[model samples]
Target chain A: MQLTGAQMVCECLIREGVDLLFGLPGGAILPLYQTLPEYPKLRHVLVRHEQNAGHAADGYARASGKVGVAVATSGPGATNLVTPLATAMMDSTPIVAVTGQVPRAAIGRDAFQETDTTGITMPITKHNYLVMDTKDIPRVMKEAFHIARTGRPGPALVDLPRDVLTETAEFDYPEHVNLPSYKPTLEGHGQMIKRAAQLIRESERPLLLLGHGALISGAFDEAREIAERAQIPVITTLLGIGAFPGDHVLSLGMPGMHGQAHNNWAIDRADLIIGVGMRFDDRVTGRLSAFAPNARVIHVDIDPAEVGKNVRVTVPIVGDAKRVLHALAMQVDKVSRPDWIAEIDALRDEHPLYPGGSGGLRPQRVIQEICEATDGRAIVVTGVGQHQMWAAQRYVFKEPDLWITSGGLGTMGFEVPAAMGAAFAQPNRPVWSIAGDGGFQMTMSELATIVEHNTPVKFAILNNGNLGLVRQLQDLFYGGGRVASGYTGNPDFVKLAEAYGIWARRVTEESEVRAAIEEAAAVDGPALIDFRVEPEENVYPHVPAGESVFETIESPAGREALAWLT
Target chain B: MVDVTLNTERVHTITALVNDKPGVLARIAGMFSRRGFNISSLAVGVSETPGLSRMTFVVEGDEWVVEQVVKQLYKLIDVVRVTNLSAESAVMREMALVKVRSNADTRAEIMQLVDIFRAAIVDVGKDAVIVEITGNEEKVAAMIKLLQPFGVRETMRTGRLAMTRGAASGARRERAHTGGSAPDAEVVP
Candidate 1:
């Protein structure tokens, strides 16, 4: 049977086992929407904004371990997806963004909504296609999914001209795509794996710095086994949060500038460091010259570029994280370091300093309450800013893949819709989004999406009345003269939620934090709460950029917090 | 560990064999720009296979950074093979077109310099001459400099094309080195 390009697209998506799509409709994509009703199994969530659609699809992909799909029209609609696409690109998430372009004749002429989306997105995507022929639709869809899901996964975009979608053509989706050049290494070289295991065995004090790759390759069990066998302490990067259980005895929570003081100390003090699936981001490595000065690094990742980009590596193993971890674990020799464990415990116990006199609804207390209420089982998502870091530091992720946040791009309007997508991906699990006042307003439009889908996502607005992270930087770096970071006006979030017809409340004191989280989570449908956190509260253990981790400010009380490198 | 290492900007000629997928060139070039590497010269041509194209580009960076960039090029799905060839083991060449001020008096003098550099005079206007030269970067640079004394009016040069010197063929050969011996006229007039 012959099918229109729109039908062909639908068929290919169904063949790829794609059951959900997030998008907004427009003039060019009307044909695709018209053909959608024929397929009852494919559920489509209409998002208010294109960026939210991209974020929702990305969140869905991360939660479901499947390729997430989003769609939009040309011009502004396509451009709005750029931020989320870049976010997915930077963090290596799998998403396929489909956009309808102006008719073939109108392209590049700026007809109605014509834009060079393929050209604009080339830098950020793993790959992209601008399909002009109806016959090429099936093949293009297959290739887009293949590229987005393989190797170091990232976003891919497909632009379909309106003429192509309307034209009729025979459809035959290829069972398998054989791109001779597109080979992803699945196993580490035996010699390199052996060398890595050897380095781990010989070192008196070994540390495992887990990154996003660990979660991407589903190497959680292998990572745990290797750490337990070799008696190496495990430290995580921001995106690597849930790969290792926070409750594990050897697991040291998030190692960075704002990472746990003990974790940073472990990174600095180790004799050998085994890195799995992570790029040593500049944020994680305070100053490259001073980072892990004592350690010999073994970097394992699917992307060879990441092996030696930020820091030097002693042994470079290029392969999938799970396969390499399994091979390397088999070669590892068992060893116990009583002295190293003692030192790590001492550092953890004595180093961290929390600020005092927080009677108002503190963000840290709010995060802690949510984690306790959910038993760390809920899927926690957050927008970028201080609340993100607070949740990262406070939430004890007892299992892998429970915590999701925009780490690399630090997109502000990510959480609300991303949580909705997460809820859709996993109906059995509870999903909650924690957002700052500044970021919440950026995409509070997603609240309608949650309501329409009736996705039972609990929304927690961390209302600090300012862009907290930027304010922190300005305060410390600009002689405490805060500038444009503060918000001149704000909305009553409780009233905002009530307007959306959702169960809503407000928590002003620290005492009401737990009850508010419990009430919100207990609701059958989506709910929201305004937790007015203390303003001027800052994230501690702050490592100023280009400085050593040892120079971290533990609190805002002393000269260190007030001091500026300039 | 008696090795001496110096930190300096080193130029490397890297060649890639990529499928003739649409936007493959832009994809590879975009990676270079996004990674903040500088491309000194880039020349691409259809390769042995119908659907495959050979790309040769020159990038200058610190030794380690260049190596990392080459590894990154390998990660792109469209790229079939990539080789980073150095100055010693590869046969590299570049072609240049020089338009110099010439008349009955300087035309003969320009021809003498062209012969010494093993170049050819491709075109001659009433008061100008277009000389074409094919050689390594140094040879091409020399030809342009020598023609400069004749009041050089204009010059255009293909960056560099390179390949390895070997008996190995097919897959192993494609990944062996970065340059090709045959210089094309893409950048030259």
Candidate 2:
């Protein structure tokens, strides 16, 4: 059908199965917005800020495993999408951002609202195009979606000039994109897979390190089968928290900066490390040189750039994680190491996490109770810092691809939108966003989005009135010195939630923790439960940079207080 | 390690197909530099196909690194084909110009070398001889090295220019003609 470029853009989105878009209307994008009313199937979510639109799109993409779409206009609108674009790039989320640029004549003349959107986003985006011709719009949009969803999925931008949007075009969206320059490596080298399998079978102490790639590749079943068959202990990164059930016999929880002591110990002792979809980020590796020093690594990722970028891979298998895992599972002989499983079980029992407090409710205990109450079925999302680490360490995610958080970028305002996205994607499933006081405040403005949508998301705020993670770092590294970490004057989050027209509650006593969570979970709309805890509380089992993961410092006061009580 | 003298008469032109991505040219150049390969002359342009770029590299490396480099270029997502005209049965040519110290007394002697090399005097200065030479890499290098004895003043060389051996001539010419017709207009948006 012959259509204007603006109508064709929406038509291409509908063809690509985009159900929703997060954006705001502006002058440069007026033509595209003018055609939006014609496409009723495509939902447009108006965000308060362009940044929020990007984050919301990212959240939607990360949770739904679809190409999240966002739209904005020139100058500030395009620039505002940078942060979320960079965030999605770092985290490898599949997103396509479409922005409106000034007319072709206005380009490079410093005309009103004219900005080089494509140039500004060059480094952050995987690929981008400036659509000057109406004929290129359909092809570029198709390619943009393809590029965004394929390989190491990342955000791609298509800047449509205002004139092109208004111009008429023969709108035939290409069914197949034939970009010879952009073919991603999909199949693993057969010999490398065999070598990985042989290494796994030969090792006496082997550990499977799961990352977000496993979830992205939808390899949870294969990952689980491999662990069960090999009887290998599994350790996850922050992104890999819900890739496998933490309650499983071989599950060692998340291992990294704020990982559990037992998980770090297991990683340290492992003879072979089979890393799937997890780039050894600094937060997870602690010290690059010292990370998994004793273990030989077999790294599998779709992106060749990530193979030897950080930790050297003894055996590098470049392919889709799910495909490689399935191939490995099919070839490997089923053998159980009973002794290894027993040892891991013993470690879990001996180093059981202790959550003890008197007047104030402990965040760790609250998480544990929530996990028990929900039966490890709820999808838990978290903001960055102490609460995030606490959720990673304490929550027992029994299902794969259930726990969602901003692992790579560690964005503070991620949890709320992410939770909303998760709730939208998995409507029947319970989604809870466990955020800290500082992180909760960053995107708390999105509480309106939650309230308006009526997403059944439960919010548990661990309010300590400080940036707990940075404060802890300063305490440990800077000799107990306090700087900007402390937020002296803060709004009462419960009152703020009430003002936003959501059910709000505060629990100071330990007895009220379980009931508050239960009450929040029962709420039909969004609910916020703020817990006032100890101000000086710090996350335990933290491996400082340039230090081995095994070398950790437990929370001094909390540990001492627990020991005294015992 | 086999020191086989290259029979230069049979070899002429080469063509390469590579993925059209940023930084690929730099990588190929870096490889040539590391192997100490010398190019007689070179030219690069986009291929007839969209998303595929063609780079013409002319160099002389040990048979091993050259073969390895060809294989390695294939491993890059962008590089589709690498052809060595010097090894293949094809036509080879290069463009070069050398400026040598010249005077009224030695102008005739300098002209003799230019004629022998089939080079032309593109420019002439009062005290300098600027000769343009076009041939294979070896002939260009030999001409420059030979003129060094006569107080060579300055030298400039294009890397390499290449085309396929046979049967592929019509395909490339057609592409070149079509590419020329586009007027090379930049997208203004």
Candidate 3:
């Protein structure tokens, strides 16, 4: 059937099984907007900003395991999406960003609303396409979705010229993409797999280091089974939170800076480290030479380039995480090591990580209370900084894929929109965003997006009146110095949330933390609870850069609490 | 490891089928340089089919290293095929013309060497002999090095041209047989 380019785009989106699209229309995308009414199944979310559209798509993709779709007009609109696109790229989120460009005739003429969207996004996207002919729209759209969701999933872009949107083409969606240049390794090499299993089997103390790739590849169950069968303690990167039930006896929780002391200790002592779906970023590994120094590392990742990019891998398995884990599980004998589990349990109990403080109405305490009250059923997303780390460290998630945050990019203002996306994807489930004062304001413009969409997301802002993470780093690393990390002058988050038509509450005293959380959870629409935490509070168990994970500094707060306990 | 130094004189060429994407040529050239292979000359052009480019590189390296280079090049996603025409039944030719400092005394002697090598003098100046020689990459290199002793002034060489033996056609024929469309020049936005 013959259809206009705009109609063809909508049809292609529907054919690709995309039910939701986050975008804001402009002059260059008017044709697409005009044809949107024809597709009733494909819902368009009007975000307050194009950046929020990208974040929303990222959230949707992360939650639903589908390619998140976002659309924008040319020029500034497309440029605004760059931040989110880069964020998604860093985190390996599957996303398809469609931008409307000026007609092909005026491509390089600097026409109004014209921009080099493709060129701007080249570095951050998996692949990109510019549609000059209406006939190419279907194929390009198919390819964009394929490229975005396949291999090491990341964002792909398709820039449509205005004229192409108005042009006519016969609609025929290709069933499969046939790009010889694009091949993603899915199966592990048999020799590599056998070698990895042998290494794991021979080790006396083994550690399974999980990363976001495990969650993205849906290998959480396989990972848990492997750990349980092998009796190996599991440690996670910040992004790997909730990959295995944190409350499990063998689960060591997040490792590295701001990670659980027990988790770090286990990683330091392990004889063999099976790192899955993780790139061993500097933040997670600290000093490379000392990271798992005694351990023979077996690294499994989908991206071949990432195998030896950071740390040397004794055995490298390049393939999909889920498939590799399943293969490993099948080949290894199921045996229970009661001694190893008990040892890990002992460490967990001895170095128990309590919520920041019980006597104070602290953000960390509130996050812990929420985790307890909800039984880890609620999906917790966090903005960047101290609250992000605290929530990651304190919450004992019992389910895989429950915690969401900007890990690789550490993007601020990610939680609220991402929470909204998560809530929308799983409507019956409660989704809460924990944000720090500084990170909250970065992308707080999306509160309007949340309110407009009625996503029913609950938000908890750790109102410490500063960029807590940076300030804490400055204080500890720079001789108690203060920098621009302090945000002394800030708006009242309660008032800001109220202005956005969200229910708001403020908790000041130590006694009000639990009640404030309860009140926020009870609200019908999106709710924001502003917890006025101690301005000087810092996340502890911090391993300074170039230091071993075992060499951690206990925060002053931790020392004070311990002294009081004594 | 078996160490074999392969030094052969023939009309030989190497044909590489690479993804017609950006930066591919530079990657291929960098690979050659990194492997310590001295490239005599190189040429790259769009294949008869679209989305594939044909690159011809003439280089000298240890046989083992050259084999390893072929394997490593195959690892690059953009590289579709690599053909070493040194041993296969093929037509290998290189065009080179050298300008030597040919005064009345040495001109005849330089001409005699060119005749012995079946090389032709394309241009001549007051004090130079421009010899045109078409054969293999080694022949061109040997002629250049040999002429160097005669005070050769300037030299230029067309890398290599190769055709398979009998009716076995090249990449163009393969693409045609596969019934694929020609590669597109326009970049995907």
Candidate 4:
């Protein structure tokens, strides 16, 4: 059938099973918006900014395990998507960003709304295409989605020239992609799987360190099977949260600078480490040389580049985590490690985490309240800050992808729009955006977006009146000299939410936390609560940047903890 | 113990078969810079296949880096096949157009040197002779060194082009190592 390039794009999207998209219309992309109304099944959420569109798409992808779509016009609109695209790249989220370009004739002539979209996005995207021909739209669109959702999923962009979008062409959508270069290894090598199983059998203390890849590959059942059958304790990276149930006996919480001390200690003593679907980022490792010093690492990742990027690995299984774990489950012998479990339990009991602030309303209390109110079933999305850590440390996640945060890039302002996206992906599940004062204001303009869609996302703002994480760094490392981290000129968040026609509340007391959460949950549309948390309260169990996890300080009360710095 | 050592001493000549598409060079080159891999030289041209292009990249890195380079290259949709030809017995060559200062006085000497090196004079100005030579790196370097005293005014060299010897194709050899269903690029003679 002959169709305009814009119609072809719409058809291609419908064919790809994309029912929801986030975007904003602009001058160069008007043709797409005009054609979009014809496609009744495609629901487009208009975002205030292109960056939010990208982030919303990212959130949707993470929640639904599908390639989320975001659209924007050329030049500044495309440029704005850079941050969210980079975030997607860092965390390996599958997003397909469609941007309109200047007309083909005016592409490089410095025309209005003309930018090198493909060139600018090449590094951040898994792959990108600039379609000059109307006929090439279908193929490029197919390839973009394929690349975005495939092995080690990341963002892929397709830039359509304005003229190409308006031109007519014969629509031919290819059923199968023929790129010989883009094959991803899905099955583990039998020998490597056998070796991993053998290492598991030989080790005295074996730990399963699951990453975001585990969740990406949907290896939750396989992960549980391997851990249960072999009696391996599991520790997750920050983004690896919810891969194993937080209430599980073998779950050791998170491991990193902000991770539980017991989890770090377990990693320090483990004899064998089987890493699935996660890269050992510096935050998780602290000091690279001292990270899991006693463990012989078995790294299983689909990306070959991630295997030896940081830590040395005994067995490098380059395949999908689900398949590798499934194979290991079949090959490994069932053995119990009571001594290791006992040691971990003792460490967990001995090293008590910070119990939050004593006098004032604490951020930890708010997070715990929400978790309790939801029965740990709600999907918790967080922006990066002290609140992020508190939520990560406190939330009792029971399923895969329930706990979402900007882990890799630590992108602030991610929660608000991302929660909206998550709400769209799973309409039945309650979605909450946990943000700090510092990160919340960065993208509060997204409140209009939330209200426009009537997305039932609850916003819990930890109003500490300061960038709590940075303040803690200044306090601990710089002799208590306060800097520009405080939000002295902050607005009343309750009024701000009211300005956007969102249901709003202010909870200054810890006793009001649960009721406020419950009230917000009952709201038909998006709602916000300004929980004025204790300002100076810091996230504890500090590894002090480059220090080893062994140097983790459980709290700031002891002067001896600061003695190592001097 | 697993050998995860990163050796930064070796220089590898790698080749890829890719689609004849625009911005592919930028994509591949951007990937090299983005991933922190050092590129010694790169030359690309359309291959025997009508729609496919062959790109030869001279990369300076260890075994791990080269492995990553091949894998990263494969990530590009335009790229079809990537094979490291450094380990194979391959025929490698580069073409250079060296414009040397050749007045009437030094012109005869420059011509004699070019003759001995089996090169041809592609262009002749009143003060310079543009000599075209195609050979391996060492041969080109040697020819340029001999002409340096005559004041070599300019030089333009195509980085490197490599092909395996006889019936042992690099893509065929790679399939043996990969042990998967990834097919070899068909060489359309």
Candidate 5:
């Protein structure tokens, strides 16, 4: 059937089962907005800013296991999508961002609202296309979705020229994409799997290092099966927070920067490290030369480039994490690991994991109370820095994919918009946006988007009056100078939320944390709570950036990093 | 834990067949640089097929890293086939034009070495002679070393291009123009 490019976009989205799109209409994308009323089943959420639209789409993708769609106009609108595109790329989140570009005739004449959206986004996206004709819309859309959702998934951009949107085209989406070069390995090689199986069999102190690939590949069951059968302790990278049940006895929670001392010691002592779906990022490896000094690594990831890129791999398996883990699990025999478990337990007892506390509100305690009050079922999304680490440490992710954070990009201001997107995508499930004072202020404009949609998301601002993570670093490394890291004239977040007509409260005492969280959880619409946590509190045991995890500092001279446990 | 190469600085020649699509080269180059792989040299051209292009790039890495590079190249939608020319039993070759400062005294010596290396002196200027050589990495390096004593003026090389030795049969519909050698000749299954 002949259709305008805008209509073809709607049809293609419907074909891909996309129900929601987050964006703001502008001069260039007006045609798409004009055609929106024709498709009643497609829901469009108008975000306050383009960056938030990108982040919201990222959140939706992570929560729904579907390609999230974000739309923007040309020029600045497209430029603003950069951060979220980079964020999605870093975390391997599948997002499709559509930008309205200048007309083909005026593309090179510096026309109004014109930008080289494809050029600027090429380095950041998995792939990008500048659509010059309406006839290619169906094919480009199909390719965009296929590229964004397959292999090592990341964001893809389709910059639609305004003229193309108005032009008529025959819409024929291909039944199958003929991308012979883009085939992702879905099965592992028998020889490689057998070698890995043997490595696992011979390993006495085996550690399964989980990463986001496990969650993305839906290999949580296989990861658990192998771990439980082999009696190996499972450690997680930052993004691997929910890949394995946090409450399981074999779970070591998380390792690397700001990880518990015992987890570091355990890694240092392990004889075998089976990295599944996780890249050995610097944050997870600490000092690469000293990381896992005694362990032989068996790395598995869908992205072949990641294998042996950072840490050396003894047995490399490049395939879908779920498939590879299943194959390896079949070849491995059950074995008890009493000695290794005892050693890990002994390490834990020697330097127990703890939480930081302060005289006023403690971020960790607030998050713990919130999680307890909610029974740990809510999908927890967090902005970067201190509060993110606190949330990661304090909350229990009972199943895979319940936790979301900007792992590789470390994006601030991601919490509010992302949580809004997650809540919108999974309306029946409870969702919470947790942010630090510095990060919450970064995208607090999203409150308008939340209030406008009446998105039922609980917002927790760990108001420390400073960028606590950076301040901690400055104090430790910059001779105690608080320049750049300390905040001045920080807004009253509760008042700001109320101005957006959202329910708001402020709690300065630790005793009020649980009550405030429970009350906010009880609300049917958007709600916010500002907990005034003490400034300058730091996340510990910090590995002091570029140092070995074995050299962690539990506390600074004048302060305790985790006083709660003490 | 076993570091095979005592020094990790090793170069690899990678050849790939990609769809003759716009931005395909940029995508491959961008991914290599973004991932911190140093591209020592790169060359591209239309292949024997109508819609396919051939690309060869030289990069520095250890064995495992080179293996990873080949695998990652497959991940690109536009790239249909990739081979690490260094790993397989294949003929590896490079082309270079070495301009050496050839005075009356050294001209005879340079010509003698060029003849011994099976190279052709393409151009002879007043003070320099440009010798075009095609061979494996070792032979080319040896010739360059021998010519350097004569004050090598400038040099340029097409990094490396490789093809499997022997005639591999390809299943292609006989087209009059192709003489039935239409590009599936290089396709690896």
Candidate 6:
């Protein structure tokens, strides 16, 4: 059928099953927006900023296992999407960002709002395309979606020119993409799986380290099956929060820096580590040389590049996590390690993750109350910082994929917009945007977007009044010399939410924490709550950067002793 | 955990066949730069295949680095196949043009040196001769050193191009016009 490029975009989006997208339209993308109204099914949520749009798409992709779409205009509009795109790329979130570009003739001529969008985004994105002709739109769009959602998914970008959008062309969405080089291995090599199974069988101590890849591949059942059958305690990376039920008996919680002491100890002492779908990131490894010193790692990932990129792997299986786990599950024997479990429990009891400081409301208590009030069903989204770590540690994820945070990128200002996206993804569930004072203020403008769309997202500002994580780092490492971490001036979060025309509340006392959370949860539309927690509080069981997890500080006294030693 | 490599460094010649599309080279070069891989030389042009291009890159890195380079190259949507030709038995060649400052008095001496190096005089001026030589790195370097005494004015080189030996290799055979022995050789599947 014949269609203008703008119409073809809508048609391709519909064919790709993209019912909703987040973006802010500008001069270059106006043609597509003008054609948007014709397609009622393609719901467009206008965001306050292009960065927020990118973040929302990221959150949507994570919350719902579908490729999220974000649209922006050329130059600065597209540039704003860089942060969120990098964030998505780092976390392996499948998001397709469509951006407008200068006309083909003016591409290299520095036309108005013209920028090398593809050049700037090449390294960050999984792949990018610049459409010079209208005829290439459908094929490029098809390829973009395929690349974004398949095999160790990451962000994919398409830079569409204004001329192409205005030009008419024959539109035929291809049924299949002809990408010879893009084939992803979905099945594990039989020999590799068998060797991993044999390693699990021979080892007395085995740790099943699950990462975000498990959740991405929907390997929950397979993960649980293998963990239970092998009697291996499952430990998750930060992004791997919900891959396994936190309440399970064999669950060892998260590992690495800011991870549980017991989990870290378990890793340090394990003989065999069966890592599934997770890269051994520095944040998770502490000191690579000293991490899991006694363990032989059996790493499984879909990306072949990641197999031996960091720590050495005894048996590397490059395939989909679920498929590999299913295969390994068939070959594994049922075995129990009561001694190892007992040792881990003892470690947990001895060096527990306890909140420090005494003057104000405990942040951990607030997160626990929020989790309890919501029955652990709310989709929790957080920006990077102490609040993120607290949420990751406190929240008991009963369901898979209920927890979302900027893990790999450690991006701040991701909370509000990401929660808005998560709200759109799982509309029926209560979506919470939990952020520290610093991070919340970074993207608080997104509150307007939430109210505009009437997205029922509960915003929780852990009002610590400072960059808590950096402050804590300075306090511990720099001998209490705090600089630039404290916020001298800040807006009233509750009033700010009200100014955005949403229900708002402020909680000062620990007694009011639950009431405020429950009240916000009761609101049918966007809501916000500012919880003033302890200012000098810090996350314990801290593994100082580049140090071995074995040397994790379990309390203030331990931190003090380590400081003195340094 | 076992440490993968000793962080040893070596020069590696790598080749890849990629789709002949715009920005493909930029994507690859950008990846190498971002990953901190040092590229010694890079040569790219249309390959024997109608819609594919061949790129030869000489990079300095260790085994792990080379492994990552190959793996990361495969991640590019345009890149179809990558072969680490450094370790294989392959034929490597590079062409260099040496513009020697030669007068009538020294022109005969420069030509004799060029003849000994199996080079051709592609262009000649009133006081200079441009010696075009096609050989491996050592051979090119040797000729340049021999021409330096004659006051070489300028020099240009076409990085390096490499192809694996044996008729069954995946690389396309030399075209019939080149008068190579294996003109219609089939590539190994």
Best model number under TM-score: 6
Q: Per-residue lDDT for A456-483 in model 6, tens only?
A: 9998889999999999898988878899
Model 2 chain A: worst 10 consecutive residues (lDDT sum): A557-566
lDDT of 2 at B118: 89
DockQ of each: 0.24, 0.06, 0.08, 0.29, 0.19, 0.31
Ranking by TM-score: 6, 1, 4, 5, 3, 2
- Clash totals in order: 5, 14, 15, 0, 0, 0
> Runs in model 3 with CA error above 4 Å?
A342-346, A349-360, A557-566, B1-17, B21-43, B47-50, B54-189
Candidates ranked by lDDT:
6, 4, 1, 5, 3, 2
Residue-level lDDT tens digits of model 4 in A1-566: 99999999999999999999899988888899999889998999999999999999988988899889999999999999998999999999999999999998898899987899999998899888989899999998998898888889999999998889999999999999877667788887787788789999999999999999999999999999999999999999999999998899999999989888888899999999999999888888888878888898888888866766677777878788999899889987888999999999999998778888688898888989999999999989999989999999999898888877888888999998788889999999999999988888887788898988899999999999999998888888777778988788999998899998999999999889999999999999899999999997989787878778767778866426566573
C-alpha displacement of A20 in model 3, angstroms? 0.8
Show where candidate 5 strays beyond 4 Å: A557-566, B1-8, B87-159, B168-189
Model 1: TM-score, first chain: 0.98
* Native interface contacts retained, candidate 4: 0.25
I-RMSD for candidate 5: 10.4
Give the lDDT of residue A254 in candidate 1: 86
Candidate 4 RMSD computed on C-alpha atoms after optimal superposition onto the true structure: 3.2
Model 3 error, position A381 (Å): 1.5
Candidate 6 error regions (>4 Å): B171-189
Best by lDDT: 6
Query: What is candidate 4's lDDT per residue for B1-189, written digit by digit as tens?
Result: 223467677989989888898899999888999789999999989998898899999999876677678767776778888777854578999999999998999889999999999999999999888999999999999999999999988899999999998887655523212211212111110
**Winner by lDDT between candidate 6 and candidate 1:** 6
Error of 2 at B92 (Å): 14
Estimate, for each residue in B1-189, the C-alpha lDDT of model 1 and write its tens digit: 001133787788888888887788888888888788889999988998899988888888767656656676776778877777777878899988989999999888889989888899999899999999999999898888888888888888877988877864325522211111111100000
Best candidate per DockQ, number? 6
Better of 3 and 6 by TM-score: 6
Which CAPRI category fits model 3?
incorrect
